[model samples]
Target: MTSSAFTESSLTGIPVKRGKVRDVYDFGDRLLFVATDRISAFDWILAPGIPDKGRVLTQISRFWFERFTTISNHLLSMDPADLPLPADTDLEALRGRCMVVRKTEVVPFECVVRGYLSGSGWKDYQATGAVCGIDLPAGLKQSDQLPEPLFTPATKAESGHDENVSFEVMSQAIGQELADSLREKSVQIYQQGSEYARERGIILADTKFEFGLLDGTPILIDEVLTPDSSRFWPAETYQPGGAQPSLDKQFVRDWLETTDWDKNSTPPVLPDQIVEKTREKYFEAYKMLTGEECTW
Candidate 1:
């Protein structure tokens, strides 16, 4: 469907926090997560977001949260009809993109699990034969599958890149026991999720997870295996030598690279073609992973 982007939302009297692509509204013990069409690249939220982007991301996360019941997630419900929304609130706009979740003390670290050498992991391996201080085999190509998945922890920054840190550093910051537990849980979830994707002809190259404590136990929080949080490569076209075809925002990034918009300044507005193509990628990912057409 042709439509304008829902870059942000307003609900009277409710405090909201805008992240890179999601708007979080605090409702005392509950938090409303609205994944908007906003897209970010090189640390800037670009203009004129691709419509339906938010729905794809939110529904993808919902699929994962529902599919993997073994892993505890913070999702209370995807429907917010029962919420005390303001009289002027746009429930139709929020449809298929809102997540109502329980509030928790979010963990400070990002639990990243890498099953393939790519992205920042590939760079680290090229430099040190390691990722997050965990050593890997030598002579591995850019997108080569690792002998085993590695749990690399990163410090979650408010803005900019999340700094990848060693597991020892993570342990020191959040105690050895908790860090170890989080790592194990992250690896386990990645293994399960990746296997499921592989069966559907998609490779879950790597994914990052965010966790929060509830009753002294860490439970999955934030987006799970959505394209925004994971690197998904088409298995049939996978090549270890370099970057493989992806079903994510790589289209947007590739287009941005061709432009001269200095990242120091405001990012350029995406062209109509670029916006539509990027939206298609998000929809394809949601469909391939969920086994259902994105009728929304």
Candidate 2:
């Protein structure tokens, strides 16, 4: 692993749009997704990102995208050498961190599926006994497993947090037919992933998926089933009464809660130990999920 974190990429002759943790370069017919080592929590970008984080996320997504053969997605290539680039582009540095995907008109919603209550789902349940308008059984704990997975959609925000919305609201905005189709696809993928993770001694408690339209056909887009987009908890240590230990960046969010810094402004940099431990967590998750060493 490199001692430095790569939070940005330089590509001379192309337009790039940066999100919380990725640098997206428009490649005309296709888009280049460069997962940077940037980390964000509670809508605030944190400093001193976990090293190899982009690689971990990209590889994990690649593993899932390749594993689910029936699902159509935007991923075209993971090798940076496959794409034409500017003269100053860093191929070696971009190796595992980059992906070339077919560009499509993205659906403006975060398709979330949850088999277990947690995060904003838990908060909403505590307040209204439902999540995205799906009522749950009474007396459910923070991390309690639900009766079945629910497709809870959210508004896709460019910045800040994505707001949870009822399926009816999403259907009204995007039309009933498309909304239902995306919900089915989202829940189906979640079930497939959750079952697989369980067999591997991990619990995919919940996850968010983004889809896009290609020739009027819905296809999965953006990152799929990565630590940044999913809550992966070790099965052996899971207890549903409260927040569980996770293999993703949730620990960093946990650590941030201990600080006096208000989450409104810029957050504090993670300590060296925190950074090291977080890196280990990402590495461990990748190793367990793929059963292969993350050479990147």
Q: Name the top TM-score candidate.
A: 2
TM-score of 2: 0.98
Off by over 4 Å in 2: none
Question: Mind giving the per-residue lDDT tens digits that candidate 2 earns over 175-252?
Answer: 999999999999999999898888988999999999999998999988888888999999999997988999999989
Q: Which candidate wins on lDDT?
A: 2
CA-lDDT, candidates in order: 0.89, 0.90
Candidate 1 overall Cα lDDT vs. reference? 0.89
- Model 2 lDDT vs. the true structure? 0.90
Give the distance in Å from residue 195's predicted Cα in candidate 1 to where it truly belongs: 0.4
lDDT of 1 by residue, 1-296 (tens): 47889899888899999899988999999999999999987778888998988999999888889888886889999987767898989899999999999899988999999999998889988999888788887899999999999998899987898999999999999999999899899999999999999998899999999999988888899998887888888899987899888888766887899999878987888888888888888888888888899887
The TM-score of predicted model 1 comes to 0.97
User: Residue 50 lDDT in model 1?
Assistant: 81
**TM-score of each model, paired residue for residue:** 0.97, 0.98
Question: What clash pairs does model 2 have?
Answer: none
Model 2 vs truth, CA RMSD: 1.0
